[model samples]
Target: MSDETPIDFSSVLASAVHDMKNSLCMLIQSIDQLSQSSSHQSKEQAEELARLHYEASRLNTNLMQLLSLYRAEKHQLPMTIEEHYIDDLIEEMIAKNEIYIEKRGLTIEIDNDEALAWYLDMDLVGNMLNDILINAMRYSKDTIVISTEIINDELHIHIQDNGDGYPQEMIDLIDLPMQDLNFDTGRTGLGLFFARMIAKAHKNQNKEGRIMLENGGKLGGSVFTLILP
Candidate 1:
């Protein structure tokens, strides 16, 4: 028998997903432009536009998670760690989602020291934060609070939404590896899984980061915290 290994289907699948995501992004842009130019007073038209946007966003999120997981499995993911200002990161993230926030009448508050800097992989960390932000926007009533601080030698970032906190069962399952779940229940589980993976990947001087879920923050809602060392 030949010594060569079998073809890797995972890489092929990931590339396909990346291609599809790019196409979907183009489609979303076209739809957005059309929606902007064509004024429709009917509720059906508005609902359809909303549905298209939602699906596009969901697909993009899924594609991102798949790519991240694939890289993680191969240990090929780049951890480009750098020292960045926490406030600037929060500002940029909020600006990127301004349209969505305004459309949903949601308000976001950033509470972080402007001078605080930390070492991290900005792209991976940004993806993780974006996922958390999207989740907060979906479940929040009208407000979300993002905060950061340094405790001991670790940095802590918190994203909290003013919605009903996650049930105890859901919070308890976050640390475990990915598992099958019912889509009908409106749970992707990938978001948290991706967040956990990103957090664990961030390490400094032999210390690693961690993610935690809690309730009863300043927002009186669910809090997703990332602790980095």
Candidate 2:
């Protein structure tokens, strides 16, 4: 046998990611429990715990997105497109974010037809929205809105916030290639890049999903739209 390293680095990375996710899941749960526990007293302490919660959430999301991108690169990320009520879908996103919304004294708005059902990969799309909400929660002033509609035979989903709006760099990202992300600007391009990948994964007929970032929204801040076909 030829002398060679037996370790498959790709498999090793995937397994390491899986194990990291398990540990992060437990850490997230523990933080949630701690937040709910009344023994937490001071306002500053609570705030710190809440930040921890959000960071934990961010890390967990990062890992999940990594695994998804990996699978997608390997053509293994299955798209589970099915008809789901738009309200229920956004509601689950709101529920996951209930803690931060309450803690920050923020308001959330939902605008969608009550009886509309749309076909898409709910898990992938939902996680995409979750990442959006997490970013919005951190940046918004006091309000966020989630709206959905069928525009021109495609499902249009928008997540808007009431704040200063996305940075000029981020708004400029719409025109840049995926490989043009600047890492030295104290920003990691992973989340937005992941969002873009997710949008592209959803395809129907001859159309495909698209993502855009805009400065002005109904909330007068920034808007992130994922148009799915």
Q: lDDT of all the models against the reference?
A: 0.80, 0.82
lDDT of 2 by residue, 26-61 (tens): 987787787788674587777777787788778877
**Number of the top-ranking candidate, with TM-score as the measure:** 2
> Candidate 1's error at 38, in angstroms?
5.8
lDDT of 1 at 62: 75
After superposition, candidate 1 runs with Cα above 4 Å error: 1-6, 31-51, 175-187
If candidate 1 were superposed on the true structure by all CA atoms, what would the RMSD be?
A: 3.3
In candidate 2, the residue pairs with backbone N, CA or C atoms under 3 Å apart (3 or more residues apart, or in different chains) clash, namely none
Error of 2 at 15 (Å): 2.5
Clashes of each: 0, 0
**Regions of model 2 farther than 4 Å from truth:** 1-10, 182-188
Per-residue lDDT of model 1, residues 157-190, tens digit only: 9999999988887787675665643235453466
